[model samples]
Target: MRTREFLLQELHDLSQGIQGPFPYDDLRKMRETKRLTSHFKMLGDDDQLSADLNTYFMAIHGLASRLLTGNAEDAPTTAIHWLARGDFFAIFPMYCFLEDEWEQFPQFAHMYGSTKKMQEIVLSLLLTEDEL
Candidate 1:
């Protein structure tokens, strides 16, 4: 498994390119997609996991909407806030891993040691984002 430091470093690297908030509509579509919800459900059978998943999705949607409609000056701050609170940074890599496209992004393959670890990270982020 990759060390936690490696994951943190990758996140830091990725964050450098984030200049503003993501499009609210795009995030909403991603969050509401049936495939993603089904994948989350398939990750676990527990109610806590399901609830966390829903809460996380809603949080992202809310954040995105707020940023989209709020002051332009607040975009960076809002983006950073949501980015820190959620696992949006890890989503694309996890999706690639789930879809067996890790080979297309060799760097992300080191983000998590295994598929199980990736799923756990996803769940953990979802459960914790609301707390932040």
Candidate 2:
């Protein structure tokens, strides 16, 4: 697991990159953003989880900005709506972990570890694993 400090830092950096208020006051605020939680934050912390979630959020946030400003590229912007739903489901595993669904992710001791890695694995599982 990454340390708590690292996770906080990454989130802080992510928030800074956002054009609007970041939804999270802390990671816990994800709870109020049900779709985000369900789709993204359930895995134990790891590099993959952190990277995947960051990428996902960056994509979402960028699309949101484009939509709000009327500057979106037609194809990418059009695709956001289609991807949004699956993005939520892809994020569910990590969200579960953040919510203290410990049994849901047994490999990591805490979320502070490699969050990006964890997210990546969960995303792969959610996206590619037919049985899931």
Candidate 3:
């Protein structure tokens, strides 16, 4: 799928009690930020950074795919733990993802200013929903 489609599906899948065909507006809101695009660009252009990040993203996506395809146990927790313990430069996108949603999500504000905690919370929250 296209990146935008993936993100929109991810948001819908991860949110609890959100009834809908899908919230295109919210997806647009999240995607409109230049900050997110910048990180994606960086991930694409920097070889070393891109290699590491690709691995991380693949791991995360594997968990997500498993969750969506009937492997619920492989949730975001493992990926989150991996991120918290790995190279700090590798997790910049996740940090930006949490920062993007934190202001609008007060409960997630607890994760603010701490990258490790934020990464954990982001994974936990994403994996908390009943539906994948």
Ranking by TM-score: 2, 3, 1
- Tens digits of per-residue lDDT, candidate 3, 1-132, equal 235346435533543222233233433443456655565445454434334534654554455455455564646665656755543444554444434453563322222223233333345445433422
Between candidates 1 and 2, the one scoring higher on lDDT is 2
Q: lDDT (CA) for every model shown?
A: 0.39, 0.41, 0.44
Best by lDDT: 3
Please write out the lDDT profile of model 1 over residues 1-132, one tens digit for every residue: 655456434433433333343234432443356655565455454424324434444444443333334432343444335445435335333343245432333333332223223333323333344644
Best by the TM-score measure? 2
RMSD of each: 12.4, 15.6, 12.1
What number of backbone clashes does candidate 3 have, counting pairs of residues 3 or more apart or in separate chains? 0
Instruction: Show the colliding residue pairs in model 1.
Output: none
Q: Which TM-score value belongs to model 2?
A: 0.34
lDDT score, candidate 1, position 45: 43
Count of backbone clashes for each model?
Answer: 0, 38, 0
